[model samples]
Target: MSLVMQENLEGKAEIPRIINDGKESVEDIISNRKQISEKQDELEEVDRELRDISNELKSYDLPEDVDVSSLESQRSEIEGRISEMRQEIGRVEHEIETLDEKVDEIDEKWREEAAKESKHRTMMRKLDFVEDAHEELTEIKQTILAQIRENTEENMNRYFNDLIWKDEDYTVELGEDYTVSVYGRHGDNKIGSLSAGEKQVLALSFMSALTKISGFNAPIVIDTPLGRISSKPKKRIAQNLPDYLMDTQITFLMTDEEYTDEVRAHLQNSVANEYLLDYSNEVTEVKGR
Candidate 1:
């Protein structure tokens, strides 16, 4: 029993050492476990960071054969082109401003030209109106003159045929210049060949026609009407004159040589009254006959 006690005391002493040593070993094991847990947490963080980097790389989706250096070169070239484009835009804007100024100038010029054109158009319209009016007046004048000429021709022919003692048929034509042309048989002009008496008869006929067509009611007076005519033409004229101018008032002042017995006999039937003018002692006196 005493040996067993001694052995137990020794065992107890040895047990404390052993337990202390075991405590040291357990502390080491616990420290090593803490270090291992820290390493695992760090590994997990690294894995998460690697996954994020892989997802970023996948989003880029770069082809396997693409060169990073070439992409960088292309980026520099694109930047250079963008700089050139900006300069070109500035130049274009300046040109646009210049063109705007030119357009404004052109617009002002066009406005002035348009005003002139408007005035020209107004003048042209007035010219057209004047031309039309002139044409209308000319036409009316021509028509009136034509009517006057035709009436004068008819009356002259009637009076001439009545008084003329010629056996041939004669035609009297009034030229546009108011010259008298007498045509005889075979269309020959007889004015140059007519005797003084015949010409006087033609002049009397023309005068009578003109007076009738003059549209005046004034009395006609004549002196020496048949002075150049022969006795036969004078008698014939006196016979036809009163009848042709039946509606007109006419007076004849004649000398005794012109107022022959034969002319008086033909005109006395148509005379309503007679007057004589006598010039003696440089004074004129009118006496009723």
Candidate 2:
């Protein structure tokens, strides 16, 4: 029985028996040491992690006199302020959106106004051109009218001097309004002071000057040619008339009171025909001489 028990113990104690052998024990010891070195490296890594966690905890450590309640209140106030700022940001964004819309509307209006301005500018240019043309035409009209006034005035003076009794004592002026003025030797207007005979002579001179300048060769007929003239003036006028009207055909209708013997003597050489009217039983017949 003791032997059987010993045999069982020897089977359970095989590891001890193997440890007693030097080569097998040494191999087992080397393997165990490698496992221990691996475990030690793992332990060193765990220790470094623990030290890092402790250092982080030290950083989070509160001071002895730190106010938790005040910090909590400040944090709550900061959160409230942040919430208000978010609301303000939302309102500002809304306002910016409205302003952008307004800006776009203004840009559209500006484009329409620019188009109208372009059209108005074109019309203004045309207006300027028309105004310039009108001004040029007005200037030309004034220059032509001025030239006519000057020529008429010169011709009036020449004919007036030749026919008038006091020839060298008067100057005639023609105004822009076609009004005639006669200035005497003393530069006084003598038109209102002239006698009927002088006035008639002046009218005849003016008519002759107009006929000469009219560029028309039509025959002139004068009724009662020397009716308002004195005897001496009528004789002088009759003498000068044929010479002055040399190129024109003129007929003078005269009465017995105006066609005196002296006037007829001065005008007989220029007279082509003379006529007498005989009235009987309210019937008149013109007989030529």
- Count clashes in each candidate, considering only residues at least 3 apart in sequence or on different chains: 0, 0
**Candidate 1 on 1-289: residue-level lDDT in tens?**
4443445455545545544554554555455455555645655555565566457556897888967567556555555555554555455555555555654655555555455555555666676798899999999999998888888988998888888888888989998777888998899999999988788788888988888888775788887888887777788888889876777888887888899989988999888987778889999998888
Over 242-275, each residue of candidate 2 has an lDDT whose tens digit, in order, gives 7766788998988998999998888888888899
For model 1, what is the alpha-carbon lDDT of residue 45? 58
CA displacement after TM-score superposition, residue 235 of candidate 1 (Å): 3.6
lDDT of 2 at 52: 61
TM, every model = 0.59, 0.53
Return the top candidate by lDDT: 1
- Candidate 2 has its poorest 10 consecutive residues by lDDT at 14-23
Strongest candidate by TM-score: 1
lDDT (Cα, 0-100) at 232 in candidate 1: 73
Cα RMSD to native, each candidate?
41.0, 37.0
TM-score of 2: 0.53
